[model samples]
Target chain A: MLESIMHWWEKKQYRIAPYLFISPFYILFAIFMVYPICFGIYLSLHEWSGIGEMAYVGLENYLNLFKDGDFYLAFSNTLWYMGASLIVNLVFSLILAVLLNSALVKCKKLFRTIYFIPIVTSVVAAAIVFTLFYDRDYGLFNLLFVAMGGKPLDWLGDTSLSKFAVIGLIAWRWVGFNMVYFLAGLQSIPKSLYEAALVDGANSLQCFLKITIPLLRPVILFVMVTTLIGSIQIFDEPYVLTGGGPADSSMSVVIYLFRTGMEYLNLGYAAAIGFVLFGMTFVLSWIQLNLMGAFERKE
Target chain B: MKRTLLLILVALMIMVVVGSSGAGAQEEVTISMWTHDNLYVEFFTRRGEEWAALHPEYKMNFKFTQIPYDQLWPKILTTLAAGTGVPDLIGIEISAFSRFMKGDIAEQALVDLTPLIGEEKEKFLRWEPYMHNGKIYGVESALCPVVFYYRKTAFDEVGVSTPMETWEEFTQAGSKLKEKDRYIAAIESSGDTPHHFLALYYQQDGAIFNSKGELMAEDDPRAIQALQFLQEGVREGILWPTSSYFDAPHFAALKEGRVVGNYMADWWSVYYQKPQLPEQAGEWRIQLLPAWEEGGRRSSTAGGTGFAITKYSKNPELVFDFLHYTYMTKENQIKRFLELQYFPTMIEAITDPQITEFSDPYYGDQKVGKVFSEAALQIPVQWQSPYWSEAIQILYKEAITPVVADKKTPEQGLKDAISKIRALMK
Candidate 1:
């Protein structure tokens, strides 16, 4: 039997060994990722409370999700943060990345490490610190304002300002991480391109607009699309700080999904919310990619 | 390859078979419980440690775990939904209980506890929140009846006396104290419900959902009146705006005497004040909640927790027996109070001379237990639906907040909240 097994193994190893080597990941992915996603899609079509029989409701959950005012509110709030944060964060990170990649900049490693430190810090801890920073009476901003003879403003309490308060913390934690990606993109560009541009009649600004910008197009598009998706599905900062308050103005799509699925225990509806988010991210990313002509270039 | 695969499969099967078949009959019954309350775990775990070895019919191996309050709901929900990994026992908070009991999930996820509660049901102080459609699915270890907690120092300084009988008197006292820059109790226009809205609205003949299981907050005249009264107090500059009572800033304000009045449960004195504002000892006192009308009910239920046996539990009868042994008995209830400061839910425990005679230095030597016992027994029973959380979210954000922020009238806000909630239901 051992002789026969060894012979069979020797004959079949080339054909089946690679699949056997990678089988564990496939098995795990099927169970954890693919199955739940498929089950979630199935759940989106039904009315379920995470227990009992899943009542088939066809498109009812999705239909209701569309008409629900809170759904729209959460969507808009998420978009607001995404739009504002994306613009400021991208511009800031690009500047930092370019400066770090510059020839004159010394201690590039130290600067890179310092900028990336917050990205590695725990999100919850950072959010807690930001919460204290936004405290109405004792917060840093209000304390400074008070010292300057201005009244202390309610940062997390006011509806108009709370979203920004949450957004600021989000940007603070994420900008460094985004800059790392830009840094990689900056480093990847051949020095010859810049040297060639400089050698021509082009000045620094001309070289930048003509050479650096176009070469970094793929990376910029990559950063922009991912940032848009991540910011839209934001949950931790607002959840930990404002708890999607003072009037649900800071609630994002993921927060709504959490509230519906977990707080309300409406798993089916929450599943619908999730699918809607997926659809939204997909469509928006597609639109963004097309707008940027990301796919137009071979690179 | 086939022989090697077959050998591996056979070995795995044998291992699986050996692993699960180790337990025999007449073995110890182990029940695991999950909760967000730390003190409860400590008390129960100590009780189990001492008493577990004494059980003859079956040994007790009780495991109590404390999960974080916010994450507990999602953890419980996901486990219950997946129909696996559910603990033998779980505690659901009062404001959150309705969320679990909202739909068929209650029936499917919970072991029907009616048979266990039996004729002793009347002994429980407040349980309507743990029931759904005439079925009792859970039993609480503590009763958190809402009462008016005021700072004696502030009220004495303002020359306002205790035991205000009606809303008129309460508001008048608040307005009178406004002269000293100290207002009445602060009402929240944000954050979780059952903090301000639930306690006040349920003080009278008012409910978010009517007896017919209909959402009536927007149209229920009593609810509308309650919201209007709360908004008016804030508008009148009598009720201080400290946001939610649970927030850090509000806790600071409480210590600073910015808002010296609070609408809180009996547990707040021990669970919150003793821990968070210990320096304010000997200056706070508990009184009956002000009546909405003359001679009206002065008590309502706030945040508390009740343990429910999950349907996933294998030995529910055993789990139930252990639960009853630890919680339902009078001796243990009193012990629970002595150890954890949980306000006893059982009538006998509450009425015990040992309990009612308990005085608190924080309340200036007042018998805190007497207030809890009196108010606890008087808390009104109101039916609730699982959709209460969703409705409450809208009620707080769209309805109640707009009124308090002076952006909308109570009527308009309520109307909008109702419409918005109705849209969510669809």
Candidate 2:
């Protein structure tokens, strides 16, 4: 029996070795990601309170979600955040990346570290600081506005401006993150391309428009897709800052889902919301990629 | 031969160590608890030591974990679902209590504490929130009777005497304060929860749900009246429209004397006011909440927490004994009051001299405890419903904000909120 086992092991070691080496990641992915996705689908079809027996309710949760006014509000708010963050973060990060990539810039490392600090800062600590800064009465923003003879604005209280308040926080934390990606993309572009454009008597704007942007398409698409995903699922900034308040004006889809599942104990409804969010994210991302010509022939 | 002898000697040593540890484990009863508040952990730890000392035969090993408020409930629920890693005991906040009682989980996940509490149930000031289907699930932590906290200096400046007695008088005092560019109280216009509204509503016998857990906010005329009172107060600029309470803007407003009055539970004085506004010592005073009618209910319960034993506990009886000795006993209840300023739910403890006669210098050397204890007996019950969290969210969004913003009348706003909540219930 020992000889037979040894013979089998010798025969299969080469084939099994590779699987053993890569099995950890696949095992973890199955347990965490795949299992959750499957379970979420099953949960969406049931009525559960997270602790009790799940009663299968078929498509009721989804049907209810379709008519849910709060869900629509949260959906619209999340789309607004996605569009705003994508534009604000991408534009600011691209500008910073271009400036930092320029030879005219000095102390590049120091500037990079300074700009990156907010990304590394604790969201809770940053939120506390921002709360003080956004205070309607004594906030720094209002204080400065008042000094400049402008009316004091309720950064977080007003329903119209609460979304912008959250957007500002999102921009502050994420601009640096996207900037790093753009910086890498800029560095990867050969210096010869810019030199050739310069030799051809193209102005800096022309060179940037024709050469730099075209070369950075992949990175921009990557950033746009990520920013879209991140903004749609935003929970921390709005949660810690405005708490999706002033009448759910700043409520994000993830915050709504969290409130449904954790706070209200509507696990089935929350799971339905989650799947809807996933579907929305997938459709948006696909459309975004298609618009960026990511699926076109690469040759 | 020497190697074999060495192995035997090592095995003997391992056996001794393992045997000793096994004996120790057999003697010790490990009890684990989870709470969101560190203060509770300290209270429990102190009580645990005393309990252990009193019961020397049963060696107790207590483990207390303090989780963040937002994360703790999810953790507890997940553990309860998995039927593993659940603590022997849990501290359930009053707001989250409804979530736990929804569906069959209340019975499956928690021990029926009714048997343990038995006749002692009558001794608690409030048990409605922790009770479900005629069975108690948790031990009440506080009476949480709401009181009106005001700045004496601000009131004196406006010539408003103590105990405004009626909401009409309170509004008049607010108008007086408004002339000096100050507001009497801060009304939260965009608060995440409808605490201000709920407190006043409950004071007038308004409840979101009836005792039978039926939706009744729309039918409750007092709820509309309470909401209109807030809207009118804000419209007249007599009440400051704060973004939220216990925040930077609210504290800044308080410090600058832009707002003076605050209505909250007894714990607010010690937990938030004294600690947050220590410089305003001796300037604050407490009184029963102003009644809607001249002699109506002056106090309403706002917030509370309860300790409960989990069904998964290996020794639930032991846990109950510990809770009874600490929370149910009058002596420890008074101790909790003196140490933590968490007004006790124990009826006997509410009238104890140590609790009622205690004076706080922060509130102008007033017998703060006495005022709260007096109100404790009159605190209106806050019934729990599965739709509570959703209802509060809807109440703030569809009702309070639109009403306060003058986009809708109180009647219209509340009607909309009720219809929305009812739709959700379907």
Candidate 3:
């Protein structure tokens, strides 16, 4: 029996060894990712309170989501955050990356490390600090504004400004993260291209517009897609900073889902919310990738 | 052959000695507990040592894990749902208790403590929040009576007296404080549940739900009145609107004397007030919350926690005995009050001299326990509903913020909150 088993193993080793070596990833992906997605779908079709029996109420949770005003508010707030952060973070990081990649810059590594510190910093700690910075009366922002002959504005108390307050925290934490990617992209672009453009009598702005942007398309596309996905799932900043408050003006989709599932124990409804979020993320990402010509065949 | 027989005799003798020793030894039992508050763990650890000293025949091994507030409930709920790896005891917050009692799972997950409580129920003050269908599942850790904490110097500076008797006088004092460029109290308009509102509403005998767990806030005039009082205070510039309670910014306002008074539970003093504002220790005082009317109830309950035995516990009776000895007994109840400064729920402990005569230099030698115990007896029952978490979220968004921010009238806001909460119930 031992000789036969050894002979069979030797015969199949080439074909089976690779799969045997790579089985861990597939096993984990199926257990953690695929199982949860399938279970979430199953859970979305019922009414459950986490511990009790799940009662089937097909399509009701979905139908209710359409009419849920709080869901719409949370959806719109999440979009506002995504749109604002994408614009602010992308522009700011791009500028920093361009500056840092320049030959005239001093201590480039030091500046890069300093900028990247926020990314590695604990978000909860950063949020606590930012909360103090956004305080209505005693915050640094308000104090500076008042010193500059302006009135102290309620940065977090007013519903109109609470979203911006949370967005400010998001931008602070993420701009550096995106900048590192842009910096790599900027460095990867050959200096010879810019030299050629300057030799052709193009001004600096023209060279930047003509050579730099076109070469950075792939990086830009990558950053935009990742940023959009991250923004859609934003929870920590708003949760720790504003708590989705001032009348839910800063509420993100994930925060609402968390409150529903964890706080309210409406697990089935929360699952429905989760599916809706997944759908939104999928459709938006696809649109983004398509618009960027990611799937287009090159000639 | 003789040597082999001698070795066998020696092994038999050793076996007999070991068996006799094992028979004389005490059985060991391990009990695992999970709590959100480290203070509870500290309190119980000391009590557990005392318990071990008294009961020597059984060796008690306790395993206590203190989890953060946000993570603990989800962990406990998931464990309960999976029907495995449950702790022997769980400390449940008052607001989260409804989640545990949502379905028949409560019956399956928690041991019915009613039989354990038995005749001692009459001695306890607040049990409504932990009850479902006439069964008690948790023993409350504190009475949590909401009291008005004020800066005595601020009031004296404004020529307003301490311990105003009615809401009318409280508002009158607010105007006087406003004249001095100070606010009477800081009311939270964002990032908090309607705890202050609920305290006042409960003071006027208002409830979000009746005994049947039906929606009653819309029709309850007291709810509207309570909200209107807060709105009027803010509009008149008597009350400052803070984002959250017991946070840094709120404490800053207190320190700067921008805000002077706070209506919060007794636990706030020990956890927040004294620790945060240590410099202003002797300048503060505690009083029964001013009545809405001259003769209304002076106190209402806001926040609480309770400990319950899980059905998964191997020794439910032993756990109950431990709880009864530590929490339900008069001596330990007063001891808890003296140590934690949480007002006792036991009627006997509330009046105990150890509690009633206790004074604190932080409040200028005020008998803090006496004031709290007085409020403890008058604490109105707060009904529980499965929709409680959702209802409070709606109440804050639809009613508390809009009404206090002057975006909507009290009645309109209450109407909106009611409709939203009702829709949730459906």
The prediction achieving the highest TM-score against the true structure is 3
Off by over 4 Å in 2: A1-3, A190-192, A195-200, B1-26
lDDT of 3: 0.90
Q: What lDDT would each prediction earn against the true structure? A: 0.82, 0.89, 0.90
Report the C-alpha lDDT of model 2 over B1-426, residue by residue, as the tens digit.
999999999999999999988776547799999998888899999999998898877778999999998999899988988889999999998888888777857788899998888887887778788888878888877778999999999999878887789999999999999999999998788775678899999998888988888897875789889889989999999888877677878887888999999888878877878878999999999999988887798898788898899999999998999989989999999998888888988888899898889998888899988998989988888888877888888998998887887888999999999998998777
Model 3: colliding residue pairs: none
- Specify the poorest-scoring 10-residue window by lDDT in model 1 chain B: B19-28
Off by over 4 Å in 3: A1-14, B1-25
Q: Summing lDDT over every window of 10 consecutive residues in candidate 2 chain B, give the lowest-scoring window.
A: B20-29
Give TM-scores for every candidate, taking all chains together and pairing residue i with residue i: 0.90, 0.95, 0.96
Q: Please provide, for model 3 over A1-299, each residue's C-alpha lDDT reduced to its tens digit, 9 standing for 90 to 100.
A: 99999999999999999998999999999999999999999999998887767899999999999999999999999999999988988899999999999989999999999999999999999999998999988899999999999999888888899999998998899898899999999999999998888898999999889988999999999999999999999999999998899889889999999999998888899999999999999999999999999999999
Candidate 1, A174-256: lDDT as tens digits? 77888899899888989898888888878999988888888888889988988898887899889988889877988888999
Compute the interface RMSD for candidate 1: 1.8
DockQ of 3: 0.77
Candidate 2: which docking quality band? medium
Q: Write the per-residue lDDT of candidate 3 for residues B27-50, one digit (tens) a residue.
A: 687878898888889888888989
So what's the TM-score on candidate 2?
0.95
Candidate 2 local lDDT, residue B30 = 93
- In model 2, pairs of residues that clash are none
